[model samples]
Target chain A: MAYSNKVLDHYQHPRNVGSLDKDAADVGTGIVGAPECGDVMKLQIKVDESGRIVDAKFKTYGCGSAIASSSLATEWLKGTTVDEAMAIRNTQIVEELSLPPVKIHCSVLAEDAIKAAIADYQSKQERLREAGAPES
Target chain B: MRHVLLRLIDPFETLGLPATMDLDAATLEARYLELSRTAHPDRNAEVESDAQVAMLARAAAINDAFRTLRDPWTRAQALCERLAPGVVAATAKLSPEFLAGAMELAEAVALAERDAAEALAERIRRALAAILADIRAALTHVDARSAARLLNEARYWQKAGADLRQKLRA
Candidate 1:
């Protein structure tokens, strides 16, 4: 299928392609795959004490659209609150990427990755909080 | 045998095969060839163009069925979707650890020296073999979930192997 200029541009020059420290207390990591196509995507975010996302990165082993999708996700993620990041939708990503119907799933994968990473970050905070709770 | 199977046949049902990861290669090949010959449009009388077109579509579907069932990896991937259609979400949701391992491997592959590439290939091959064995055992014991897990793990190794090959070639 012929990709739109936006899609081709993102595919050609993806942004924030890499990963973050998944084990860090403030780092949230998300990994999602597309069942329709066997594509893997990893998205990571680093949040500060105020819950504002400070950095984001991604690594994808997938098609151009898949790579572009996650790359775009990272770009949107930086500087957003975790809640704001959670609200990012696949349709918005699709609009940003000009993804074709077939590649809508790529955007969905990116959305899923964002939510997963946020969830991971929240859970880690919960664990830290639990560990630090004063003894009864 | 061919005419009877022409009616609304799913790929697995067309091959008269179970929707499982483990398939006998010999049986798949034999059935594919048998059906190919049976479904050939030329085998139908040349009287009507309509019949020929219908036969052609059927033949194409049969070839597609064969393609879907032929590869072990794809067979499992397809079977997962088939057995649990609503469970598309269950497939390919890799873990953070798995992703980390994959990223590291990808980085290694990017800068792999000759010996390093070969070593990584060997490791991926071994991992593939182990996963296949687990899949076999899982299927034998009717452990579908474990079988899916094994197949999911195998996907990583398969990609790693492919990436390594491409890198080495470059």
Candidate 2:
């Protein structure tokens, strides 16, 4: 498949391509893969105390579309509230990247990764709250 | 009492064997030879052109079936597909811990030294062997999900192994 220059650019120079400490109180990490294609993607986010995303990072073992989708997700994730980030859909990513029908699944994987990271972060917060709760 | 369409699409059916992963290489080769002899275009030279074409197609399908059935991994994939129709068996829905481990291996593979690459490839091969053993058991029980997930993990290692080879070649 001939990728657009835009997809190629994101793939070649992916944004925020790294990891955040998943054990940290403020970091949420999401790992996902497509079994059919054997591609994996990891997306992590650092949320400030205000519950706003301060930073996002991703590392993907996938094709150009998968890499580009996660890279673009990280770029859009920064500074968005958790709710706003959750609202970000695969369609938007598809529109922004102009992904073909076949590669649309890549965008969905990216979106799922974002949600998983947020969920992980939220669960961590929940666990901490429960741990520190006063005894009944 | 299997469906006719399933029989048509089944690689084992093409090779005149039961749809089991435990088929021996000798048996497969013998069946393949037998089928090839019957379908060889040269033997059909006296037949009409259309019949010859049909034989050619059958021969091609047999070759395709054998090629896929010959590999343990490819055979596992085919078995998984048969067990779970339309299931996207190799996608990212893997467990979190496994994905993390795969990412770490992928990173290590990308920058390993020659000795390290060889060591890592060996390790991956071992891992694939273990996973394949589990997959074979899963296939026996018709546990499609477990088989699919294990096959996907093996696919990751196989790909990493291939990537390492390409890098070493470079």
Candidate 1, B73-153: lDDT as tens digits: 656545554554423235456666776676666667667899777787888888788877776676667665666766766
Candidate 2, B52-164: lDDT as tens digits: 99999999888978887888877776777777763433343778998888888888888899877878988988998899999999999998788877877876787788888
What TM value does model 2 have? 0.86
The DockQ of each candidate is 0.42, 0.60
Q: Find the 10 residues in a row with the least total lDDT in model 1 chain A.
A: A31-40
Candidate maximizing TM-score: 2
Model 2: per-residue Cα lDDT at residue A74: 95
**Candidate 1: residue B112 lDDT (0-100):** 80
Native contacts matched by each model: 0.31, 0.69
| Lowest lDDT block of 10, candidate 2 chain B | B1-10
Chain A TM-scores for all candidates read: 0.94, 0.96
Interface RMSD, per-candidate values to 1 decimal:
2.9, 1.7
lDDT of 2 at A50: 80
